[model samples]
Target chain A: MAILNLKKIGVSGVNSALHKIVENSEKDFEIRNPQGQHSIACGINAPLNVEIKGHVGFYCGGMNKYAKILIHGHAGVGVGENMMSGYIHVKGDTSESAGATAHGGFLVIEGNASSRCGISMKGVDIVVGGSVGHMSGFMAQSGNLVICGDAKDALGDSIYEANIFVRGEVSELGADCIEKEVRPEHSAKISKLLKSSGINANPTDFRRYGSARQLYNFDVDNFESY
Target chain B: MSEDIPKTHPRKSATFDDYTLSEIRRAAATGIYDIRGGGAKRSVPGLDDLLFLGASLSRYPLEGYREYCGTDIVLGSRFATNPLKLKIPITIAGMSFGSLSAQAKEALGRGASIAGTSTTTGDGGMTKEEREQSEILIYQYLPSRYGMNPDDLRKADAIEIVVGQGAKPGGGGMLLGQKISDRVAEMRNLPKGIDQRSACRHPDWTGPDDLEIKIHELREISDWKKPIFIKIGGARPYYDTALSVKAGADVIVIDGMQGGTAATQEVFIENVGQPTLACIRPAVKALQELGMHRKVQLIVSGGIRNGADVAKAIALGADAVSIGTAALVALGDNNPELEDEYKKLGTTAGAFDDWHEGLDPAGISTQDPDLSKRLDPVTAGRKLSNYLKVMTMELQTIARACGKSHVLNLEPEDLVALTVEAAAIAQVPLCGTDWIPGKKNEILLS
Candidate 1:
C-alpha cells in the first residue's frame, strides 16, 4: 500500500500521483490529511482501492470508474458525482448533491445527507444509513435509493422509475412522486442493500417510493398542470 | 391574359408575409409556441452595417506580401498556470454532441485543430473523438451537468461555466426524443426516446457568490492549471461582465441574441437578450472600469459570419470571436443540394430552421445512422478548414488596409457605422461625420 499525505505533498502532487497511478497500478492508495480538498482521486479509471482519511471537500472521487473509494470522514457536495461503475463508502455525513447524476455505482453514506441528494441519479444505488434532507432524488431517472432513517420533505420529486426505500417518516412528496406498497421482492432487494451498507435494519420496515409517471407524455390537458 | 387588362390580384403584405401568417396560424392552432434551433430570423443591426476606414494618404498601409500581421492571443493569463495560446482570434463555439452528430463534432474538432484554434464541448458532454481530434478542447460546465466529470475537466485546456446562452438567456434547452440516440442517452444519463429538459440554473451554484465558490472549486479540481471562463448572455453585459470578473474568470465569453441553439422557444430566442452589435461597448466599458481590460480576455459570439465581423468585434474591444451558426453552414448544414428534402419538410434550404426535427438531409444536426453517415468528418473538416483559412485571409486583408500590424490593434477609430442604429449600438462615428451617438461633444469656440 502507498500512502500519500496531502498536507505534505499538496493537491498537485496528489493529482499527478493519481493520474500516474491510473496509468499503471493495481495497488491500494491511502490518502491522508485530505483537509477538505476538492476532486481527490477524480477520474480514476483503473481498478484500485483508494482510502481517504479525514474530511474531504466537493467532488471527492468524482467520475470514478472501476475503482473502490473509501472516505473515512465526512464528504462535501457531489461525492461520487457522475461515477460510472464503482463503490464509494462514505463513513460520515455528506453535504448536498451526494451521488448526483452517477450512472453506475454503489455509494454507501453512513451518516446524514443534505438536500438534493442523489439528484438526477441514473442507475447508481445509494444506501444512506441516516436520514436525508429535502428534495432528495429529484429528477432521478433510474437506480435504487435506500435511506435507513427518516426522509425529509419533497422526497423523490419529479422522479422517473427510480425506486426509493425509506425506513422512517417522510415529510412530504413533490410533484409526480408517489409511495407504493413494499412488495416481497423489495424486501429481498432492500435486505441485500442494507446488508451491504452495514446497517442493522429490517427490510420489511421500509416503504417504496417512485414516480407516478404522469409527466412522461405532454398532453393538451396537462398543459395547465405544467 | 389580355395585354392591357388591369388585373386585380390578391396581394399579401410583405411585412406580414406567408411565413408570418403560417406562424400565427400555427400558434393559434397548437396553443403551444414553436420550438426550433438556430438564431433569430428577424433582421437586426449587425456587423454588415460597419465599414473599416482603410489607410489612405492620411495613414500608411502595410504591404500585403512583405509585412507581417500578428493574430496570436493568450487566454487565461490572469490566474491560470497554463494559459491558452490560440493562433487565431476565431474559435468554434460550444455545440453539444447530442445537438450535433458524433461525426459533426469530430469534424469541428478537426477543423479547429487545422486552423490552430479551439473547439468547445457543449451541454451534453465531451466525446472521445472531440477530445482526441482537437488540440485545445474547452469543456463547458452547464446547468444540467450532463456527462460532466472531473476527468474531462482535467483533460480540457480550459473550462467555460455557462451562466446563460445568448439564444435563450433565462430559459432551459430541450432535446426532442427523436434525436436522443443510445450514445447521447448514455452520455446525458437520460433514457432514450424521452424529451430531455436541461435546467436553467445550476444544481450546485445559484448566484455570483456561489459562482465564486464554484470557480474556486473548479480551480482546485484542476490544480489551477486550466483557464476558467464564464459565458453569459448579452442581456446585461455591464453587470454580467463585472460580476464574472469578480467571480474569478480568466476569460469572459459574452454571447448575444443572434447566437444559435439546438432547441428553444421561438419567442424566447427572438425576444430575449441584447443584439450582438449593441453588447460589445458596454462589456468593454465594464472591463475598462474594472481596470482588467486586456488582462482578462473577452470572447464575443453571436452571428459572427465573416472576417469583417471578427475585425469589427475586435475593434469594438473583444479579444476573440466565436462562431456557431456560420460554422455549421461551413460544415454544409442546410445545403441547397438537400433543397428537395427541405421542401418536402415544408421549408426551403436557406430558410430551414427546424433543426430540432432530426431530419436534416446534410446530416450535421441529425442522429439517424444513415443521415450521419453522409457527413464524412474528413471531408467536412477540410471544408471547414478552407472556410477558416478564407476568413483569416479576409481579416488579414482588413488589418493590412487599416495600417495595423496586428488584428488586435484594430480600434473603434478605424470603423464608421453606415446607419444611425448601427452607430449608436456600436458606439462608433457615423460615416462622413465626426459624431458618435450618446457621447458628449463640445462645440469649439473659434
Candidate 2:
C-alpha cells in the first residue's frame, strides 16, 4: 500500500502516481487531503484499489477503468463520468450528473444524489442508497439504475433500453418513460446489484421504469412529445 | 384577324419559386419536414468572389518549377507535448461511421494518411478499421458520447471536443432508422431500427467555465500528451473563438454553415448560421486580440472546394482547412456514373442529398450490405489522395504566384474581392479600388 497526499503533491502528482500503477496489479493506494479539488484520482486504467479520504470536486474518478475507487466524503458533479469499467463507491452525497455517460462500470452512491443522476449512461450499473433529485436516468441507453429511496420529479425521461428500479414515489415521468411491473427477472437483477453495492433493500419493494419506446421512430403523432 | 391577336405574358412569383412551391406541397402532404445530408445549397459570397493578386512590376514572382513553396504545418503546438506534423494544410473533417459506411471511414483514413494529414472521427465512435488505417486520428467527444470509452480515447492521437457542428449549429444530430444497422446500433447502444437523436448540449457539463474543467479531465486522462481542440459553429465566431481559447484549447476549429452533416433538417441547415466567407475574419480578430494568433492554431471549414479556397482561407488567417463534402465527392459521391440509379430514386446525380434514406448508389453514405460493398476502400482512398495532391499543388502555385515562400505566408494583401459583399465579409479591398465596405480608411485609391 502507498500513501499520497493531495495537499502535498497537488492534483497532477496524485494522478501521475495513480497512472504509474501497472495493469492487473490490484495495488492498494490511500489518498489524503483531497480538499475538494477537481479531477483527483482520474483516468486510472489499471486494476487498483484507491481510497480518497476527503471531499472531491468535478470529474473525480472520471473515465476510470479497471480500478476500484472509494470516496470517503461528498463528491461534486460528474463523478465517475464516462467511466469504461470500474467500481466507484461514494460514501456520501453527490452533485448533478453523477455517473453521466459512463459506458461500463459499477458506481455505488451510499448517500443522496442530485439531479441528472445516471444521465445518458451507456452500460454502467448504478445503485443509489438515498433519494435522487429530478430528471434522474434521463436518456439512459443500456444499464441498470437502482434507487433505494424516493425519486424526485421527471424520473427516467427519454430512457432507452436501460432499466430503472425505484422504491419510493416519483413526481413525473418524461417522454416515452413509464412505470412497468417488476417481474421476477427484474427483482433478481435489482437484488444482485444491491448485494454487489452492499445496499440492504428488498428487490420486490421497488418498481421498474423504462422506455415505452413510442418515440423511437419519428411520427407526427409523437410530435408533441418531442 | 387571328394573326393580330396578342397573348398575355406569363409571369411567376419570385417568392413562390418552383422549389419553394414543391416544398410547400410536399410539407402539406407529409406532416414532416425534409431531412437530408450535405450543407446549404444556396449561393453565398465565398472564395469564388476572391482573386489572388499575382506578382506585378513592383514584386518579383518565383520560378514555378525551381522555387520551393512550403506547405507543411504543425498543429497543437501551443500546449500539447506531441503535436501533429503534416505535409499539407488540408485535413479531413469529422464524419461518423453510422452516417457513412465503414468502407468510407476507412477510405478517408487511408487517404488522409497517404496525404500526410489527419482525419477526425464523428458522433458515432471510432471504428477499429479507421484506427488501423489512419496515421493521425482525432477523436471527437460529442454531447451524445455514443461509443465513448477510455480505450479508444487513449488510442486517439488528439481529442476534439465538439460543441456544435455547422450544419445545425444549435440542433442535435439525427441518425434515421434506415441507416442504423445492427453494428451501428450496438456501437451507439441504441435499438437496431430506431431513430437516434443526440443531445445538443453535453450531459456532464455546460458553459465555458465547465468546459475548462472538462478539458482538464481529458488532459489528465491522456496524460496531457494529446492536443485538445474545441469545434464551434459559425454562430458568434468572435466570442466563441475567444472562449475556446480561454478554455485551454490547443486548436480551435470553426465550421461555417456550409459544412456538411450526415442528416439534419433542411430548414436548420439553410436558416441557422453564417457563411464560411463571413466567419473567418472575426475568429482571427479574436485570436489577434488575445495575442494568441499563430500560438493557438485555427482550422476553418465549410464550403472549401478547390486549392483556391484553401489558399484564401489561410490568407484570411487560418492555420489549416478541413474538407467533408468535397472529400465524399472525391470518393465518388453523386458521380455521374450513377446517374441512372439516382434518377430512379427521384433525384439527379448532382442533386442526391437523401443520404438518410440509406439507398445511396455510390455506397459512401449507406449501411445496406449490397450498397456498402460497392465502394472499394483502396480505390476510393487512392482517388481521395489524388484529389488532395492536386489541391496541394494548386495551393503551392498560388503561393508562388503571390511571391510567397510558404503557403502560410499568403496574406490578405495578396488577394482582392470582386463584390462588395465579398470585400466586406472577407475584410479585403475590392478589385480596381482600395475600398473595403465596412472599414473607414483615411487614404483611398482615387
Candidate 1, residues B1-446, lDDT tens digits: the string is: 77799877999999899978999999888877798999887798989999999999988888895799888999999999999999999999999999899999999999999999999999888999999999999999988888887678879999999999889888877898888899998888777887787878777657897688678767766768899999999889999999999989999999999999999999999999988988899999999999999999999999998889999999999999999999999999988999899999999989888888788889988999999999999999988888888888889899999998999999999999899789888888888776677883532222
Query: Which pairs of residues collide in candidate 1?
Result: A85-A104
Model 1, A97-196: lDDT tens digits are: 8988888879999999998888888789999999999999988888999999988998998788799999989999988899898888889999998888
Evaluated with lDDT, which candidate comes out highest? 2
Model 1, B259: alpha-carbon shift in Å?
0.6
Where model 1 places Cα greater than 4 Å from the true spot, the runs are A1-54, A65-73, A181-185, B1-20, B442-446
- Tens-place lDDT digits, model 2, residues A13-64: 9999998876455399999999999998889988889999999999999999
Worst lDDT run of 10 residues, candidate 2 chain B, spans B437-446
Q: Give the docking tier of candidate 1.
A: acceptable
Each model's lDDT comes to 0.88, 0.93
Regions of model 2 farther than 4 Å from truth = A23-26, B1-4, B441-443
**Two-chain DockQ for model 1:** 0.34
What TM value does the first chain of each candidate achieve? 0.95, 0.97
